[model samples]
Target: MNWVLLIIAGIFEVAFAACLGKAKETTGNEMISWYVGFLICLAISMYLLVKVTQELPIGTAYAVWTGIGAVGTVLVGIFVFKEPASFWRLFFLLTLITSIIGLKFVSN
Candidate 1:
């Protein structure tokens, strides 16, 4: 359950980051709304991440949270945001996931 929350925190972190990017790209009031949403989500994600860290090892929690966020952000950027889709990109993302799984055992 704690791991679940950590993963959620990671995902939200990715979302907020993407929103920040989009907000910067937009114009006027809509841009302000996006930045606001991004900031709020960022704060919540950090709070949840801190909660998970209290129970888990610092190294494990940080690695997993950041790893998930990186991979998830790339995925969302490619699929939902239509940034790009390529074999090389997918290959790297897979490598990241593999590394995270490896760290789970290695850190423990």
Candidate 2:
């Protein structure tokens, strides 16, 4: 359950990052809307993270959260924002994913 909430929190982290990216590409009202979305997602993400940290190890939870955020944001950059998906980028992403999984397995 805690792990599930942690994953959701990480997803919100990704959402906030996506909102920031969108905000960068817009102006005026659109930019403000994206910023608002960012704030909302940020709040939810932090809330979930704090909740889960009560049960899960802080180091593991934080690494997994940030790992999910990093992986998700990079994928969003590639697919949604049309950023480069170079070989090295994908290679490192795979490594990050592996490390996250490894942490989950080693943790309670």
Candidate 3:
């Protein structure tokens, strides 16, 4: 259950990061709305992370959560945001994902 919350938190972290980028690209009212969404998503992400850390070790939880967020944010940047997708970026994203899975396997 804690892991589930952590994953959800990571997803929300991705959402907030994307919203932040979108907000930066917009102007005035649109930017304001996007910024608001980013804040809300960020709050939820942090809340869930707090929940996960209640039972999980802070070091492991934080590392896995951030790993998921980084990979997810990069994927969204590539797909929805249409940012550049260089070979090394994809390679490192896969490597991060592999490490995340490894963490899950080794963790109790």
Candidate 4:
């Protein structure tokens, strides 16, 4: 359950990052709306992270959280923002995903 919360928190981290990206591309009310969304997602992510850290090892949880955020944000960049999906970028992404899964397996 803690792991589930951790994953959700990481997903919110991705959402907040996406909101920031969208905010950068807009102006006026839409920009404000995106910023608001960023704040909300940020709060939820932080709350869940704090909640899960009580049960999970801090080092492992933090690494997995950032790992999920990094992997998810990169995919969002490639798909939603149409950023470069170069060979090396994808190669490293695969490795990051592998590491995240490995952490989950090795952790208690």
Q: What does the lDDT read for residue 65 in candidate 4?
A: 96
Locate the minimum summed-lDDT window of 10 residues in model 4: 55-64
What lDDT tens digits, residue by residue, belong to model 3 across residues 1-108?
899999999999999999999998999999999999999999999999999999999988999999999999999999989989999989988999999999999998
* C-alpha local distance difference test of each model: 0.88, 0.99, 0.95, 0.98
Backbone collision tally, model 4:
0
The reply for model 1, stretches above 4 Å from the true place, is 105-108
Model 4 stretches with alpha carbons more than 4 Å out: none
Give the Å shift of residue 104 in candidate 2.
0.3
Candidate 3 displacement at residue 61 in angstroms: 0.6
The residue-by-residue lDDT of candidate 1 on 1-108, one tens digit each, is 778898889988898988987987899999999999998889989999999888889788988989998998888788777888799989998999999889777764
Which residue pairs show collisions in model 3?
none
TM-scores of the candidates are 0.89, 0.99, 0.97, 0.99
Candidate 3 matches the true fold with a TM-score of 0.97
Candidate 2 structure, TM-score to reference? 0.99
Clashes of each: 0, 0, 0, 0
Best by lDDT: 2
Worst 10 residues of 1 by lDDT: 99-108
What is the clash count of model 1? Answer: 0
